[model samples]
Target: MEEKYFTPEEKKEMLALSRQLLAHTREIQERDDFKRIRHIISDGIKQNHYRRDRYGINPTIHNLNTAMLLCDKISPDRNMIIAILLFNLCKTEFIPTEELVKEWGDDIAKLIRGLLKVSTLYSKQAAVESDNFRKLLLTFAEDIRVIIIMIVDRLALMRTINHHPNEKMVHDVAYESNYLYAPLAHRLGLYAIKSELEDLSLKYTNRKTYTDIAHKLNETKVKRDQYIAEFIKPIREKLDATGLKYEIKGRTKSIYSIWNKLKKQKNDIDHIYDLFAIRIIIDTTTEKEKSDCWLAYSVITDMYQPNPSRMKDWLSIPKSNGYESLHITVYGPGDRWVEVQIRTKRMDLIAEKGLAAHWKYKGIKSEGDLDTWMNNVRDILEAAETGPMELMKNMKMDIYDKEVFVFTPKGDLYKLPLGASLLDFAFHIHSKLGMTCTGGKVNGKNQKLNYKLKSGDTVEILTSTAQAPKLDWLAFVVTSKARNKIRQTVHEMNNRSATLGKELLERRFKNRKIELNESSLMKVIKKLGYKTVTDFYDAIADESLDINNVITEYEGLDKKIPDAAEIRSAEEFQLMTAADDDSTSSDVLVIGDDIKGINYRLSKCCNPIYGDDVFGFISAEGVIKIHRHDCPNATNIREKYPYRLITTRWSGKLGQQFGATLRIVGNDDLGIVTSITSIINKERDTSLRSISIDSNDGIFQGFLVVGVNDTVALNNLIKKLKTVKGVKDVQRSK
Candidate 1:
């Protein structure tokens, strides 16, 4: 499909959409500003600068739809609407950023730039299911408005995806809507958009299931309507007697939600209860919201028997996403369990519109709660140690999970996910507390570390210096923060043990008058069948691998030692020779702004390859160490010695190969190892250095060191490995 001039029909639709948008946005934007925005987009459309989207929809028409969606769904401000309308123009450079900024203001310009960055990210085929992609999207979209606009834009795309001819693209967009955009809408409290996106996604991706459920709901519509009417009649009379102003809505759960229930409960649509919910939106003042809701609840419960176990109170403590409502499940007519939600008009608006509505109710404390939650999301994205898919699951939990509000002994309250354990609470409070927590006393009763916490429990953490994070703790902690912290601590401990073990072996080698060859020692370890270098070092650290045994194995191994003149320490390596510089002159890596004759070597810790983003650190030994920007030690070094940091950049690719290690996890299928090694062998100027793999329960984790010239080569190799059968994830070993 290619871009075509807009047909007469398309032009008519665009004009109508433009008018609707202007009408809806009148409250937020001036008439002149809106016209100016429309004129720019219209000019771009005439010039054919705005190409047709994948669905073959006119670009101008699509932008109008997205802009109107933002207006109708979120009631966005003038700048947001302008940004979406002008996104394509700015992207195509028909209107340069400077011109747009001059015409508009800084805020609109920033939004366009962010939108462009996210568009570029999409070009890389970033999967929505990957947490890394989500983090990157959030990073590029520094403004929350950017995220909101993208969600609305996706809603527009999913709405029109059916027109696309590419089945694969349709599937991708549908799954992306379900797994990514829907969760985002949920997190932002866009309940209506979230549910609609979910339903649309389900309809496209699983048409059979969607149709089956839809058909069943349609067949039972009359019966369902009758029951709802019967249930609301008595409550309406009772509410009117109390003189409360309210509108009760009877709505069925979204098709996606019903599908989830059917799969989870292994039941048919006819058997699933609570498919529909009753929302009692009261027109009350903010001060009277709670009292009116409680009064309505008293009236409803008086009419029908309420289930004590199913009551949810969010009025006292609103949800992290700023949702405030009182939920009750009661046995209505025909002994049906029906969920009833009570909330004020303002609260209902916030619940439906999410972050956008928060602007209208800025004085409410829930807005701050939403802001804090977004910050926490950023932290989780940055600090999480799990794989992309696992982090995605954790993010979904954060978005849609029921919150349990627990208090500290000091009366400070913390909101955790439902089923959060005692250890999760400790970690949520402070990482140090989590590290040393022995157990906790919940509501003044002693509880074990694995004890699941309930709402309103005042917890006092019991700690001991002797206690530390364990591998077992990872199995129980429900929060991503707790799980990541445990894994990080355990990894650091193992590294420490490995370091001590290495030092011990080195000392022994020196005592034995044996020159320690790093490469030969690695060969010896592998020959002894150790699957990981860390395991080898751990064995030695615990005295399981005897010094005599290691020494004998090292002596027996075939080895090659470089000449004595070639051996040098970081102190001895003062500069790259003329020959060295000339060989790689085409891709000169400038150290310290091209300080001539100064020496630097890539740090062994992170193994910075050519083309890797790097920084130079002046070590205590007076030698400059080049490290990857994301080096594990980079954070500590930068924080402690800010003065020693120097900017580094690569002007071109280096000719020499660099040592890079990859950590691969996949199923332990037959010949999986051979499949991996074959790919490495097929690459030019790339060779496998060493490999160590461990298998358990049909899954394997392998570390393969390879020699590559640059980060490009390393990335390409990783991509190829990812395509291998049974390979789940392949990542550079930091």
Candidate 2:
């Protein structure tokens, strides 16, 4: 295939635009900061390969253009702005560079860094730690400018998405933008960027659906455009006659947005009406903003019947992202419901830029507000150490939840996530307040912390130094902050309990004169297959592993127990031993004369070490038939001849190898199979007969039939396997 490059005509347009942007930037480059920025951009362009390919021979050309555009948007010094844009592009492309001097010289550069830190890098696979990584990045972004740069990057990418070749890449980027970027944009009040990102992302992630919708819209383009133009003409004329400065524009919904509507509503493309909408931008003083919008709404309603429920009064209380507009669904020509948005130009700008606009226009005067909010999210993550699923769940509910505007007792307004309880409100005040939370009053009425707060509700959290967090608090708390705190407390309690268990074991061992070292008791415990001393102690404490039993076995008690001959005949011994339980013995009747003692030991094939049920039957050669309690053949034989039933009981000392089977089932995860094998190797001196594991449909099922000392050893081994991460269940065969 021939390599594709920009067409000559396209190159000409790019160069022309680049020169214009450069000229605009130079107009404001007289300042010292601008001179430094120009130097950096010039140096950066020369060093960056991608920049050279994208811009002209002079890399400064594109850098200059980006600078000029950004400067025009926010009146930052031209040089400083260019330097920042250059840094952003260079870092994003991974260009090598020496450390930067003059740390705070360019505010724009600082913002770019912040944005880069939070922006998701393109990856072929979904990241396992993507969510936690994002949260960590956000924690480090002290400046809101970072958020602006991120939005700008997304907008730029959308504007130039045609350059990318891979459809999957496009789809991935779109999916990310829609799920992460768009929501972020909405949160930050960048309505324009948010909507555009959503549309662009939707276009790629669902191209087929997007194409179908676009095709339908195009088929009706002429009629739709004519209706929209005619519909807006009367309103425009009326507004013009009133001497109100207003601009009217008709817009087709982004392909993605239309496609989404179709999918969500399960309707055909033709049924989607919000697709063709009109935006009315007005120039008004802040004081007359509401009045102007209301007037426009009246004009629109007079021309078309309005859908009462479809009207959104964002003008009274703007969205959390700082979007302010009056939206109305009006019945237009052909009985089509067309949506209209009325907003001032200032509102439009803020809506487009989001938090960046806020920083630029309003400045970060309230330094504590953003930091406090971020700290709350961090606290929740810390508490969620018990499990990733819990952390993700609580963080989604609390940190990324929709906002509800609430008030303090003194009447200061605060915004919190929806479904926030009084505890969340208390934590929002202070961690101490949350820890000591008792009950609270909402809107001057006494209420529990579990009270579901609504928008515009005044909340006063009651606290006491005597009170502290309880396990029950997790039930009602919605935010990560509260849940994390609760988890932290619980984790501490568990650690303390484990510590106490360890102390108890150490003290007991010391009293017995058993030195706790890497060898001797410790080594033996590890050899027997425990991960850590703490785990051993925990097992002992839980009675899963009896320390006394282990000690008794270790001390060599074989001499104290009677031999197998004293309990049963050689034939009987063979049958009872097959079950691997020393506590049981079986009686067998020899049909032949008693042969002189030919010493016989329990067969190791089925060690029948201890606690196993067994039976014996006479064989053709007068040898005893040994079988396990539930063995198929043994059950049949016992049923056929009721008088042939043999009694068996285990009565053997410890430290004897017995063959046994274990079955494990669990959710498969990395290193889990290895962990199981490791546990078996460590717990007992044993050899696996044949181990097999089959994983399908996210579940892992496996069996390990191995040789071990006794039933206690097998039980201990099973306990150890259960502790391996992601091992859901472990059971021994009867």
Candidate 3:
């Protein structure tokens, strides 16, 4: 792609602004030690040039106009800080320089990148890609200033979206603002940005609905304002009489929120009760803040009868994001349901700015508790998978899921996703604890691993080294940490087997003096059209690799043949079949057929489970073994033993519990396992015999065996397992 340079006029304007910014930057540099800020800004501008070329956008006056508008929305000082942060963040090689380019150049680039990263913190994509979560977590972990920059960036974008014309772009920006930015602003206590983003997103995402509701609200604007003014009169007088300073203001619910209420409650515009809310901001000491708020509420209720059900006491135990207010719905004059929120000015600011406000006023050097919680969120996101749909679903669940506050035996409170299981509790304590968790006790009562934890429940996870993850536990455990630990353990075990298989193949090849170079072997293996070397090794390690076919192709090329039959196959084949079976003449009967005078062994791949359809394969050792037809080795044996095949059926009585393995893959969720177990146990006759589950990057793979009667019952069990929350696919073990 040809490089696109700025037009003379555009360059002149940008250069002029750049020079102006540079001059002002000198003062900030001396005051705040921003020495490297200039270099960062220069680099950002160069990078933006690269992106402009790639995106095929001419650096014309029109584009410059958009950039100028963006600049207008941003403070130069704040943009400078954001620029420094972005330069530091983009030091990694994976992020292309072109993608990091900003139209407003480097000054805005820093802010844009910081904002993008922060936006990603609550994004669906962040949930799927662990690296994204790690990046975001580390960013927040280091300095919350990055988050503030991000919020500011979004606010600026929302303000300047009018410059863009793409409907899809507009809708996306609006949806993002609504679902992610708005809630995040609310969480961070950036009420101004939060409310604006919500209103903007609502305007675009649901224009018709927003317009209808907004029109209705506008129609009643005068009456609503007058009513609110009248309603706050008595409360203001009462507070003045109590000798406390206070200010009263009125707020209407955001249009988007009103539309949601209309849809959820199946109500019209007129039926919305909390449409117009009155705010009572008071000035009080922290120690007496609650008392003063309650006193205000009492005064308001005395003048207007309060609806007991409509009262919310967030002041007692604030939200996870640090929102605090006393919300009450009272029957106002003329039977109107007037919502009132009472809080001190400090509380109001905190409620508006969330964690940001906390940092600003508290002047705490670090994020402290908020950082810890966000780190946990990072863990969840890192363990989740990526993709638009997957991210959207999982991100919504993680960021917006209802939280339950549970206590440890030591009285420390841990906030967990609602419906979290005991396993989640265990993992929340420590990753190792989750891996070794056998069960747990909720409030002094011993319960299964799948036990649903409730708020205020004191949980103690039962763990042991001997108690590794059972496949069945995958059904009951919730929380990404627990799921990720389970997945890592299972992957390690599978990988060990794969490694062993590779070694076994290498040793066998070496015994024949055949040099097995990995590169050469892989070429030959690929020529045979195998998908992966591991698949070939797994086949060989499982004694399923067809050496006869391999050797037949290479016969006479080398002269290591002792006999024609032995030469027809490979030496590896002889070693595999040389085991003695004659010493054990046990006639193991299966499926009403007796293979006399031959040793019989059960295949571990399928476990046969007593009632599964089975077959017998005669080995070179004269051992007749039973295996399910769906076993991984079945296809090889079937192709080799077309004439030797014997149809076998099970005659044994069904057992209450049979050993089998099920592989499941699905979208990850907070309480997936618990939901699965709840479904399984709901039948009462079934038990989760054992389970091993692992999840990372939003993909969940589990191996489970549950108590069942027969194949029919197992299929039914799988059918039921599919209904478990967050489960995508369940397959019977081959």
Candidate 4:
């Protein structure tokens, strides 16, 4: 309940711990580099403290102290203790890893590297949470001690969380503690640390739940203590008679756990029977360890009637986290159900301290237990999308989830995340089986691919060669393996389709006269607005494009007209005669495929401007005639002579003269024609070739023929012509 600063008690303990650490390790005080290593870490800590404060960062002195104390508590390994001392300093970049490794050795250096990775795993990033978590979860491969150190570090920080000033920081820390760290701790069999971390996290993340449970527990502490004393009296008497060296303790449910049950069962604290459990820890040698637990279990059951359904014999098969115990519920005084746990002292120690203790008291069975535990953790991470948000979003389902053991057709059991689907099961077997599986029978009844599987169901996957992965399969499948395999299959299928389509296009182009370049073809494809070659080719293969027509679209691109009436491909016509910098030879701008070595004349019927939409036709005079698309004779000409219709547009530059006629309407006023003529003459590049006017009944109408360089110049002239006295409108005549 104190704001854990550098109190005298902590200082004394720190002095004692430092002395004990120096006395124990051959790598540190017993070596030539002891003073140097100590100086480096000590100096780094001071500088880091100053740096954090200088940058308006929360000083982590208390956090460092807490971590150091925790390291000593978890293990007396000097490498770890010194690593803890310098971990924060290195994380904050006040000191580098080279300094530690150079002075101390590789053992310390390796642990520091693992600590650095642990720092990165929780650093804020743009990536989703699961990605960071996936890498973090795999840190066991780096050094088993890294995770042990990390778990202890997290426990230390949670214990001193009130020191953090930022509300968001506190929330993030607490959230990760509850959802990630505590679950990890529980998995490692660090029951005490796990429970405390949960309670601390709930205190910050959900204060109301934490406070309510703590308040209720506190108010009834006297009555609960008395009940525990009374309940253990008979058990203690029986255990003493058996001459088993042991310790009996009463364990209460953590506030967070209690709060969870309260919300789940909707029960008051008083109604929550078995809110605490009695743990019987007996001492035994290695040979009699299993027998001792059974002996203790019998003693407790003899004093009470055991519930047959509420018994768990984990002593026979220890938990994956190296937890070995016999758990049972028995009716106590006044018919109240009380849970009990019996374990050997070594088992109890491992249960209390988790992986660190297990490593200290090394056992062959513990090694196997850890292998199984770590394999499960790795499997969950490997099979799932381990993005930051992905893992964080489904932490409840992945990290703290209850496991379901389903049987394959061969009766072999496979553990899956709760709510795993049938498709997930198939993918778990093999990617190919998953892709080709159509459906499966769950417990002899047919079920869909997305059916949520339950424990003990015997699944028989039905597969067919015709069955292939679909795009929609990603929506229903949750496992990363299934989703990624589906994506890979889709990609391969698309590539095959695109290859075929590209081949068909190349052959089609070969049948035509013109050559096709992949670059030019791709340019045209993109200009048509397709995102990728895959989409374009998929369309081609699916009949969305007429391959023949598309191939011909590019043919005759550079055609030349030799005879008057000779016609080429009715495709885009390009006026390639115009030079890039010099457009004086052409009056009209042309846009389309190249129509080089051809002379074209403007048609008299439509008098199209430089920017007007036009088409070309080979005339009888050995020249191409260009006409506006909306010309009076355009429809009749195109419908009667479809092959003669060629798509084209004018491509003219500034200072190139083009001809257009304008019509004007105005009020009949004196000097109106003269005023319009003056305005047109004022334009920079204007030639008023001719003008005609008629005035009657106070209204005037005029027609003017003009030549200008381009649409910009012509538009400028028309705008000035509209400003003439009494003028109503001026428009280019078609």
Q: Give TM per candidate.
A: 0.46, 0.40, 0.43, 0.44
Candidate 1 lDDT tens digits, 448-491: 99999875567999985435577888878999999999999877
Write one digit per residue (lDDT tens) for candidate 2, span 1-734.
00123346545755686566556656445556445544555454354432433322333334444444444433334434544455644564533333442433344445455545444332212342233223333443445444444555555555555436766656666766776566555544455667778777766666666667778878989988788888877787888877889888888876766776777878877677588778899999999989998998888898899999889898999865466788999998787889898988888766444332343322222233443443344333234445321232223223323556566665555556778888888887788788777789886899987998875566888864325466778898888988898778655544543554465456545644666554566655765688887667555533345454455444433234546555321111111123233222232211113322221223222334455666544321112434466643444456643443444444444544556767678876646656776777676466555454555566777656677766677778888888888878887643
lDDT of 3 by residue, 1-734 (tens): 22235566556866675555456445333443333444543454565522332223332333223333323433234343434434333544324556555323543454445444544334323222121232233333233334434455556566556435677777877876665555544444455666778888877777788788878888999998888878777777887898888888888877877877788889887877877778889998999999999888888887888889989898898866676889999988888888888999889866434443443333223334544454434333234443111222222112223556566665555667778898888888888788767788887989988888864567877864334554566787767777778877766544543564565455545543466666666666665676887666555444455432343333333435355354221122211112221122333233224324434555544556556668875432223457887666567657745544555555453433455567777776646766776776776556666555545576666666665556777778888888776778898765
Per-residue lDDT of candidate 4, residues 701-732 (tens digit) = 65676767666777888878787668899987
Highest-TM-score candidate = 1
User: If both were scored by lDDT, which would come out higher, candidate 1 or candidate 4?
Assistant: 1
* TM-score quality measure for candidate 2: 0.40
Candidate 3 local lDDT, residue 124: 28
Cα lDDT, model 2, residue 594: 35
Sorted on TM-score, best first, the list reads 1, 4, 3, 2
